[model samples]
Target chain A: EPEVTQTPSHQVTQMGQEVILRCVPISNHLYFYWYRQILGQKVEFLVSFYNNEISEKSEIFDDQFSVERPDGSNFTLKIRSTKLEDSAMYFCASSVKGAITEAFFGQGTRLTVV
Target chain B: AQTVTQSQPEMSVQEAETVTLSCTYDTSESNYYLFWYKQPPSRQMILVIRQEAYKQQNATENRFSVNFQKAAKSFSLKISDSQLGDTAMYFCAFMKVMNYGGSQGNLIFGKGTKLSVKP
Candidate 1:
């Protein structure tokens, strides 16, 4: 089965540095999303992208965070000046449709900011 | 806004036994989707099962099944004949159906229940 693939299974960055997480969603999927899960916490939705633009975002998705589908096949999330609290597992997911269709999740990129 | 709640923080069941993980949600939308995702030690999120709010009949996938009560807004997952591989963190998620402007609604997940299958 086709699955979402994320780059850099693990990343360690210093505080105040920038980090970019990459994801290759299923080719046919149109809806893409970025979710965050702090250690020992529930997964929280950060943002959803469709039609090459952000469709919706949660309160946690502040100005520091940005997502782009630069080449139609690769979706990327960039964080400007990472904070210590930003350390968590970031998941990339994609789905054919929103409601009934299930979202396929990547193995996740564990970002650890020191 | 939709919220999913998984009351049990941790649960354990003997191998070959049956266990149920509880989940409830608060949503005013009549059309929505509920799902149970399992994350093993590898931390890979795997889809265990899913239930549609409009479906009255429960959905079953092999040894995994769901008891979906749309009226009560309750969706629970039951694992029968559990095995050692069943040990994982199970999350309950809720998603609302919205097709306006080709935007699919985001998923709201609960805290998750850590299930351990003992030998």
Candidate 2:
């Protein structure tokens, strides 16, 4: 019953500022993913990482967003320049096996850009 | 592009009554998987149920059950004897059958239905 854990449950930042949300995925899970959910909107996929590299990313993950597994246990999403639209709940998910398997999500990081 | 559709934006049911959340997905892939997740006020996404497209039988987990009609592209979740805790935003998701990228399954989520189960 291990779960993915994210830090800074809520964060507020100004426009043009840089922000990094951290996550510690389930220890034994191999695949990691980042998703964003704007207020009253559907959850949107941002990126997925495996084998220490990005396997897939969406258009929303343009130049502003990047993900890295800096260490064995941590997965981080860095936003180079925050925009008003970037405010949302960022969820980190991990699966024992990629897309076909059930992915468990973290409590989520609420990022608010002013 | 694949789309997961949840036509109901809001639904209400009295405690102990049954409620069903409808979902329909558009996917060309013959093999795939469907999932239903619940996000309560805490905003944490919790898995509710899952169904494999290839399976003819519906998948049920305790009070949670799914009516998966592969031909109709429908996967609905039913909460039997709904409880107050069942009030939340429920989302329907789609996952590809093949995960060449490995254990990380990319999911396509629906707009979500805000369900209110009153006591």
- What's the TM-score of every candidate structure? 0.95, 0.96
Query: Tens-digit lDDT track for model 2 on A1-114?
Result: 698999999999999999999999999988999999998899999999988999888889999999988889999999999999999999999888775677889999999999
- Model 2 C-alpha lDDT versus the unseen true structure: 0.91
A27-60: candidate 1 lDDT, tens digit per residue: 9998999999999999999999988999889999
Cα deviation of A7 in candidate 2 (Å)? Answer: 1.0
Q: Which stretches of candidate 1 lie over 4 Å from their true place?
A: B99-103
Q: How close is candidate 2 to the true structure, as a TM-score?
A: 0.96
Q: Tell me which residue pairs clash in candidate 1.
A: none
Evaluated at residue A91, the lDDT of candidate 2 is 97
Q: On residues B6-111, what C-alpha lDDT tens digit does candidate 2 reach at each position?
A: 9999999999999999999998988888999999998889999889888899999999999999989999999999999999999999987664533347799999
Chain B only: TM-score of model 1:
0.95
**Candidate 2: residue pairs that collide:** A97-B103, A98-B102, A98-B103, A98-B104, A99-B105
True contacts kept of each: 0.60, 0.79
What DockQ does each candidate score versus the true complex, computed on alpha carbons? 0.64, 0.72
